[model samples]
Target: MYEHSSTHPADPTTPADHPAAPDGNALTRQSPFRRTVLRRVLPAVAAAGIGVAGFAGFAHGSEGGRAAAATALSRDTAPGSALTARAASVRQAAAADFPTWGTRWVVHASADVNSPAVGLINKSAAGQDRITADYQVDTGHQVCEGSACSTFMAHLTGPVTGFLTVVAVDIPQDRLPGVPVHGGGQPQPGGSRQEMLDRAATWLTADNGSQVPYSQAKVWKDGYRQDCSGYASMALGLPTPGTNTVGLATDRSITRPVSLGELKPGDLLIDAAGDNNNRHVVIFEKWNNDAHSSYTAYEQRGGHGTDHRTLTYGLPGGDAEFKPYRPVKFGD
Candidate 1:
């Protein structure tokens, strides 16, 4: 069902994925000075589980204060609790299951046992800790601290839980998966047309063709976002974590606009306006017919994972925002 004819079927209506909103109420009333002071002191107080009365005085009007109090209380009641134990276990498991693409750590955090972890940040060689990629931890859902939830695709083995575990591993430069490497392990600016299509095909049936799940908030194990732009980046052999649709469309170094008639295999059709949820991109495969009214394309959509289907985007009476662009790497 991955391939389709020129009479393209109606695309499935998928909900837009959006990042989580900040909890504005958490620090709304605290002055800068008070907030700074609280940040330095709350961790120690929470760990020691002391000064409940004193901390309660500060909790009067701030959600952050109340949340801190609750944390302290939880720690006090169960020093070295099951969640803590599970964190240690998950950390080891993540390390043992480290991916070959690069060396990074998964720092896991959770709200409670009933809910899945809210944060899973990866620390990369640049000394920056971020949620650059996502994998399914278990049958349950996994979410970043301030991002939306995505479905579980790959499963994590061992004693896994709804708690956070941080695992760190080192990846050598030469082994960056999926992207072509040259000049002592540096990823090439772009890939060949066949290379792009081959890379795109992997996700269609990931893990020997099982299909990587669709996720705006998570990255596939290959270290690319599991969204349209990210998938396209993998095919193009761009750097890890990929660029946004706007970046792909507007970045002259990456791609240049082309007329609809100029599109070739491995080129792109990107809708580069609006926010992440509104914008979309697809990799051009080939025209479905000699008439040039429809073409087959590969895309990692919200509801569906990787798909190769016929589309009329940018053709007459089709979606106008989706303009064609050729990857600079092709040099065609």
Candidate 2:
């Protein structure tokens, strides 16, 4: 998972929130621009480079495994070989240590908001070089100043919160609620971006409040807190763990990064600045024009704890661009 504490560059007004691009093109009026749909494709080659299942118990196991281990101890821990060995050991140890559904464990460090937001530690993924402990904060009545506000704000409300879950555990910006944004607080069946977005919108209506998960849909100013990628992950109903990446729309914390061309409907587009980041997550309605025309990016903004609008934005502008990273789809 990516860290949120790193400094982000200044944002160049986006078409999603702003009406036009820096080039004087009326982004709000354009139609069918180049649209990228991010989907849960297979794990990238780099993901495979890291071990996926179980801890390392092969040290005293099979014949071939033992010889490989001996070679590893002798050699300077070869690339793939050392990684595999280390992953295996981690898997075994983790399995024995934490007997749970998921092999991953979420460890937290004690943090004080008044103090700085650094110096915490954690155990990194097996065979990996770093540790992976996250910070845990109990939201009290006090309100935080900026993005750290989530820790001070109340549980989020609105259609977005219902289909919500913390995608990035490593750098926990907000205490992600384990509720579905659309499917009545439970995990809904996966489907196309339109399907998910439609479901969420439908549930967002005042009449459907009874059917959705949240107690009410009123904008709770502090009810929910999310950056761009966090909003996208919640809207898509993707697992919290799978939404880890390094750069682009998600801040590398929400859903893991995928091929830019593989953009999906209801995908998140983000540009972060010093204190806050500009975010836009919408459904990729269709691909139109000769790849130069405007595309539809549907999103629900502002109406968070207030009456907001779910509008469509034109794409491929300063706020929108292709971000390619080692794709790691979120799931078990």
lDDT of each: 0.45, 0.25
Instruction: Give the CA lDDT, 0 to 100, for residue 219 in model 2.
Output: 15
TM-score of the candidate numbered 2? 0.30
Over 53-107, each residue of candidate 1 has an lDDT whose tens digit, in order, gives 2221111112233212112101010001111222233334322233311111122
Model 1 C-alpha RMSD vs. true structure (Å) is 16.8
- Backbone clash total for model 2 is 43
lDDT of 2: 0.25
Segments of candidate 2 deviating more than 4 angstroms = 1-195, 203-231, 238-254, 258-260, 277-280, 290-292, 303-332
Q: In candidate 2, what are the lDDT values of residues 59-101, reduced to their tens digit?
A: 1121122111100000000011011222223323211010001
The best candidate in terms of TM-score: 1
